[model samples]
Target chain A: MNSAALPGFDDILAAAARIAPHAHATPVLRSRSIDAIAGCSLHFKAEPLQRAGAFKFRGACNAVWSLDAATAARGVVTHSSGNHGGALALAARTRSIPCHVVVPENAVAAKIAAIEAYGATVHRCAPTIAAREAACARVQVETGAELVHPYADPRVIAGQGTATLELLNVAGPLDAVVVPVGGGGLASGTAIAAHALAAECQVWGAEPSGAADTFESLRRGEHVTDFVPDTICDGLRGTLGAPGFALLRAHAVKVLTVDDADTVTAMRLLWQRMKLLVEPSSAIALAMVLGHRQRFAGKRVGVILSGGNVDLDALPW
Target chain B: MNSAALPGFDDILAAAARIAPHAHATPVLRSRSIDAIAGCSLHFKAEPLQRAGAFKFRGACNAVWSLDAATAARGVVTHSSGNHGGALALAARTRSIPCHVVVPENAVAAKIAAIEAYGATVHRCAPTIAAREAACARVQVETGAELVHPYADPRVIAGQGTATLELLNVAGPLDAVVVPVGGGGLASGTAIAAHALAAECQVWGAEPSGAADTFESLRRGEHVTDFVPDTICDGLRGTLGAPGFALLRAHAVKVLTVDDADTVTAMRLLWQRMKLLVEPSSAIALAMVLGHRQRFAGKRVGVILSGGNVDLDALPW
Candidate 1:
């Protein structure tokens, strides 16, 4: 074990308490059709219906709520392509504080509209990670707003863990829990909670094969900074942040990757069969279970459907 | 008041017992965002997630299950464009009996696929309602399968009523319940259930203005015929069946109409804000509530989302 002094189940519980008022305890759905296809009993924790359209809301709300009175008065700033910006904007609005979101110029119009709808000021940047970070920093300095990193903050990770807490509370004694890894906030939170509640339950992380940096990092016992991701699961494109990686590494979560084609197939299956309109990012986790069937057969498994912020016009068939 | 006897709450309770193993007790959803938009607290009774992808499953399941052993041995048949065919097919499959569905030649490929997937044989006919009924009669004559009218049968109406029974059991008392009207099975069933359990709670039916035959019939105090519908809500294009209309007449349910464009807009809004993937037919009820906002303002309302059997490739914008 690496034995890194990272936040544990206690921290996750505290985060849950902090975020209880702001976050929705999203439903856990079970489908016999899905279970029969996967050859396992599956519990789907639906966070797509969560506030601001994703589990990002849990973390964003927690991060925004944790700020001191003076710091909150100064406002909060972050950078995101879609869900996170909307989440932070809504969270800040709830606190009567200003929110400044640095968004990519090419971000979806609907997502940008949602951010603005929640009373956030948007600063458009070039469609690059570097440009987003630079724009966020500039806005923080110019507006005297405290920077709230999307996935790097400890409070955000704790808030994200609250979802798994609710899932386990409803699902009860699953053999494994799978979560999609974008920047690893959800994965880390889920791993910590699952480990605390049921030590025997294996905690696994699903990532897009097109964006398998977390998988590579877990395999190498260190962070991997080498690849550019080009997956349809746009939400999982970013590399895992340091705090998230540390918690995941300490918890020893197994990482599996699903290809983009399988992700689209999963999305269609969910919509057509399950009547759920989840996004490509959420489908990635289902794709992992389906593609890697031999490893999960006959097990009681739980999977987090991270969000449903899909643009119907741009759905990849 | 014409007191021509119709099935009541007791009949719906019997239907629930008969279809308990066959039909899903669908989920109920509450959303703060929807409440904010509609200026009322809203509870969505989600029948869209029912077996065979609609609330038709309840009626179909009850109709099939209510058949005598000799009649069941002969099997069953129905005529439908989509949902009822699939629902009957699945319900018959549960009894290990053959099912024949008379479908229009122009029926959508996805619906045809669903019918076939449920182990039913499809008999193709011309696109007209007369042609569909003629084809169904021919299939019954040839196969000796008993005709199970989709919405006209008393057993089917009784089964559909179970949805409201379950809704009231779960969501408690509400000021009103709104349901979509096609052949009037769901609306009549819901009205009967509400009258029996919560007499003070008003029951209303929503119809697309493009296919407002039911609305016109209610206004004229008689059945209307010889009207063609050109609405995008394919599932709600059916004219009111005799038994269904009789039940509605006995119950005196109010009917409201909304335009097709507003139905599409409501579908988009539900998808974007509530993360619910409902069909256009289902959205019509929501459109009525939104378009006639004064009728439901500050009230506790329940809306039945009848189905989610939509073609993702051809979603009407």
Candidate 2:
């Protein structure tokens, strides 16, 4: 993909402005105990407190609102079993457009209910990425709706970047910005915004060892599509999207993988020390810093707590 | 106890100034999902996100700062097994003075560790009010340190009131303000602040049914002093402090009691919907309001989430 096809800082700025009226500028929380444990000053961007209880709302809102009149009139469709579906449903609601989501048959019941609660039509797929995509494509063809591919879309990438943009603007001069990578929308956007706003700042992406496609992709210098994710971080189970993968490679964003146990430990620590209710996916960013203290020690690190949409009855701990 | 001895709105203003450089002016968090379920506009004053993970820091800071230079030079002493001890310990550290906390032997190890982590000298006593007080008095006499009673001191009362003062000032006029009544310090402070700030606003106190002294005290028109607390809300086990009770009575604060089950449910909902890690004691405030929605229905109610210090292994659920 050409650089022109990828999102830039201007797109991020526009996304920030476009979603301001809808999305929350979630707080930047600090914890002395957490900092002491990590041996670094960490500023946590709490996207768990965002509009749809996740930062996915940023990208979803940007995609839904960026649509031209006729395209928007036909509504939007996507395939997600997590925050993205709920976020897109909520975003489409703002524009009074219909949203169709292709979720897996084995998806968490609570998540499906949440997506439906946000007014999205749910189509159960056969618990495979290929099945989900096929179902989504069928919905798009039948309804003449636009497919808002979660992370791969330029608008969605720009929207995700706004979180890091807000964090850098408020926290000021962070030595590094770290984001949890799943499909890589957030990490790609974070890299673009961090580079554009804070030239000296380095961006790193943390992925689950159970779902280390992004880590493998970066190491092999190409997208790695084969992996059966077995992590506690449900949100970080997807394969890295091509556009996001390309953008991350181009920006030289380093990728690291943390074990599920470490992510759970990080989640508990965040809950205990920071008084934040974040999911394993959100906690992985902090886990990355703690696991590799030599790289982040004594530095000001900005961590994006991606989301907080866990089932309370089935907590990993 | 006389009205003149109680903290006034002016004292709250003074406390705010005294602790401005130390305490966090905690954010007012709102959730449409919570509001929809409760049938009210529930604005949460998130003190769980405050220093020492509770609102106790406000009172502790105010008391520490209000001391004369010579008195402050001698440090401070208190008897508490929970957030108060940790709060006072942190507060004393800010003033560069020693702090001695008399915690009971039966206190949770996590709570004790947290208090000690705040740099306080911990003296363990038998799990009895008399034993705890004796140890506190001993510490004060031996070290020439001032005793800052958790909820009874005028300065502490004024300091705790500042949470509600800031909330009223920022969240605008509320129809009612509800706070968890652990020993009645926060309730007393909240009542005084609400009455002074919004004369028409009703102030309500929530207590665990197992530790329902405050509810019974308000009902009997006297401070009830005997009962072994059996609730999961460890922070509310203390008998209602005399000064706090007198202030609550003077301000005509209504008191309500909630079962441990309801408190746990409220805590889970707050964690799930609001993305906050609050203790069961803090959740009781919202439980009281939700249990009696007829009173708060369609009204703007300010609910104070008092603290967030819980053992992950021993969650009520």
Identify the leading candidate in terms of lDDT. Answer: 2
Write the residue-wise lDDT of candidate 2 on B170-202 in tens digits: 899999999988788898889888998779999
What is the Å distance of residue B181 in model 2 from its true position?
Answer: 1.2
Proportion of native contacts present in model 2: 0.86
Q: How close is candidate 2 to the true structure, as a TM-score?
A: 0.97
- Candidate 1 on A1-317: residue-level lDDT in tens? 01123557887887788888878898898887788889988999999878888999988888788788998999999999878899999999989999999999999998899899899999999998899989988888888898877787777787788989999999999999989998888898899899999999898888988899999998888888778998999899988888877888888899988889998988888887788779999988898899888889999899999999988778665
Clashes of each: 0, 0
Model 1 Cα displacement at B61 (Å)? 2.0
lDDT against the true structure, each candidate: 0.87, 0.91
The list of candidate 2 runs beyond 4 A from truth reads: A1-4, B1-4
Note the DockQ of each predicted structure. Answer: 0.60, 0.81
Error of 1 at B288 (Å): 1.5
Tens-place lDDT digits, model 2, residues A60-136? 99999998899999999999988999999999999999999999999889889999999999999998888998999
User: CA lDDT of B216 in candidate 1?
Assistant: 91
